[model samples]
Target: MPTDLVTTAGQAAGRVADALAGLDLAGPVRDLAAALPGGRTATLAARPGWAELAALGGRARRHSDALDAAARAYLDAEAAARAAAGPA
Candidate 1:
């Protein structure tokens, strides 16, 4: 794949990861839970939701890192190839 495409994909993934990281779901949930009567209900509502959000963010970050690595590898390969060709 082209370096530009890979780099752009990486950037997009990074943005997604950033957006997910910025989420304040827990605070809202905690506030809402506090308004409610029971601790168990709050725990049930909060844990799985945040876990899934965290997992999604992790996946986006990993994807961004992989794309960045691929872009770097491609650039390195191109540079090496050009160096091997030498003065052409």
Candidate 2:
């Protein structure tokens, strides 16, 4: 079911996020920004404070959180619907 797929995806994302939660993205972001061909965007990504790195990590975290929340909501709604339907 779609809910099952969502659950699996959310769980996978959450697990990955948890594992990489402490990872520092600054250096990698800087390296990538330097290597990228983009103009000012690359410069912004490589900024000294690593603010872009923080933002990137924050966005990923938020995405993972959103997925998990969506999965929970879908599961909850399915359960409620099934209960209302009752028996088969």
Candidate 3:
């Protein structure tokens, strides 16, 4: 897929993950857990999947940049070769 698409998808996934995590986990389980010893210390972090997707998007962008550079180099070389070969 295009790097742009990958980036957009990554951003969307990250937003969704953040929204999911933002939800309150109250009720019995939360109460029970909080009733335990160190439940108050229990904190949730960002999901690994969203992070991985974001990383992938960054990687794709880098790869795309590299690919563009290589293509330009190839075209330049081809143009040079054609010029060296004289009219035709």
Q: Which candidate is the best by TM-score?
A: 1
Better of 1 and 2 by TM-score: 1
Give the CA lDDT, 0 to 100, for residue 38 in model 2.
Answer: 76
Provide the overall lDDT of each model, using Cα atoms, as 2-decimal numbers: 0.83, 0.74, 0.52
- What local lDDT does model 3 show for residue 38? 53
Residue-by-residue lDDT tens digits, candidate 3, 1-88: 2544544555565555555544443443445545664545333222123234445545655555555555566667778889999998
Q: Tell how far residue 73 is off in model 3, in angstroms.
A: 0.6
* Candidate with maximal lDDT: 1
RMSD of each candidate relative to the true structure? 2.8, 6.6, 9.6
TM-score of each: 0.75, 0.56, 0.45
lDDT of 1 by residue, 21-85 (tens): 66666677767677775778776665646546667788999999999999999999999999999
lDDT, residue 63, model 3: 58
Q: Give one digit per residue, the lDDT tens place, for model 2 in 1-88.
A: 4877876776777666666666777887777887885787687886677544445555666777788788789889989999999999
lDDT order of candidates, best first? 1, 2, 3
Clashes of each: 0, 0, 0
